[model samples]
Target: MDKKDRSILALLQTDAKLSISDIAERVNLSTTACWKRIQCLNEGGYLRQQVWLLNSKMLGLGVTVFMSIKTSHHDLQWLRKFALGVRDLPEVLEFYRMSGDTDYLLKIVAPDIAGFDRVYKKLIQIAELFDVSSSFAMEEIKYTTALPLDYTHTA
Candidate 1:
């Protein structure tokens, strides 16, 4: 990727609805060239699926919980089953296997504590867990879906 490609990505990250013509104009590239570059980026896996971010608060899902999970089962069979169970839960927006004290981390959003309790109940039913801890987010100081392009290889 070159400077222009990086610029294109930056603009798209800001607003995915921007037209090819608008992107072309901003990046100082012709429409056709801009389209080609975008296609290349998509083909090369630099561009993942495009999605519209929804307002959780407006949608009645204002509560955000960061759940830390620790389990004794480290085998693949247990992991596969646990992963599949977590994937089935729509309330879990993000899940990760981590190092250090925490075995797994889950970012969950719900309507309230009662709603979160429902998810927690289902989660514990998935498998035998050593520990499960949760922390509620009081305020979102900074949150963004956009990633920095400074680390991208320049041509």
Candidate 2:
């Protein structure tokens, strides 16, 4: 992507509510050009779906646990079953594949200890996973949706 595209992305990253005209004016481009650029970005898969970030505490999901999981197998058959099981669990806010001793890392938000217990029991039934390391989020110091703009690449 070019600098102009990056600029547009940067603006949208901060506040997606900006109108096409507003964006065009700021970037010194015509409205049609700005709209076309946005459309191209969407078509090219640079623009993902927008989200409304919610407060877990206000939603009565005050407990946040980061669970590190180590699976017995990463084979396609076992992975498929694990994927399906996680989809049914409402408490799993985020699931990620990482590089470490853990195969999967989950960011789970539950209402209480009882909620966590129920989810944990269900996880065991779904896969042959034996290792789990869970940590609680005591306080959030830095949380951001914006990516850093300072990556210098050599091509």
Candidate 3:
């Protein structure tokens, strides 16, 4: 990737709805060149799917829960089953296998405590968990889908 490629990515990250001509103008490239660059980026796996972000509060999903999970099962089969189960849950926005005291972490959004409890019940049935701890987010200080492009390698 070169400087112009990086600029194209930065522009797209800011607003995915920007037209090819708009991107080209901002990056000082021809419309065709910008369009080709974007295609290349997509083919190269640098660009992922684009989707609109909705307002959770307005959609009646005001509660955000960070759930820390601990489990004794480390076998691949158990992990596969657990991962599949968790991934199928629509409430789970983010799930990660972490190092340290927490075995796994899940970021879940729901309408309220009752909604979360329903998810919690389904979660416990998926696997034999050693411990499960949940913390509710009081405020979101910063949230963004855009990633930093400063570390991109240019040629």
- Against the true structure, what is each candidate's TM-score? 0.99, 0.87, 0.97
Model 1 segments more than 4 A misplaced: none
After best superposition, candidate 3 residue 25: deviation in angstroms?
A: 0.8
Top-scoring candidate (lDDT): 1
- Using lDDT as the yardstick, the better of models 2 and 3 is 3
Local accuracy of candidate 1 as per-residue lDDT tens digits, 24-52 = 99999999999999999999999998999
Pairs of colliding residues, candidate 2: none
- In Å, residue 144's CA in model 3 sits off its true spot by 0.4
Query: Which ten residues in a row are the worst by lDDT in model 1?
Result: 46-55
lDDT of 2 by residue, 48-134 (tens): 877767787898998889999997797999988998999899899789888977889998888988888888888889889969888
Per-candidate local distance difference test: 0.97, 0.84, 0.95
Candidate 2 scores a C-alpha RMSD against the true structure in Å of 2.3
CA RMSD (A), model 3: 0.8
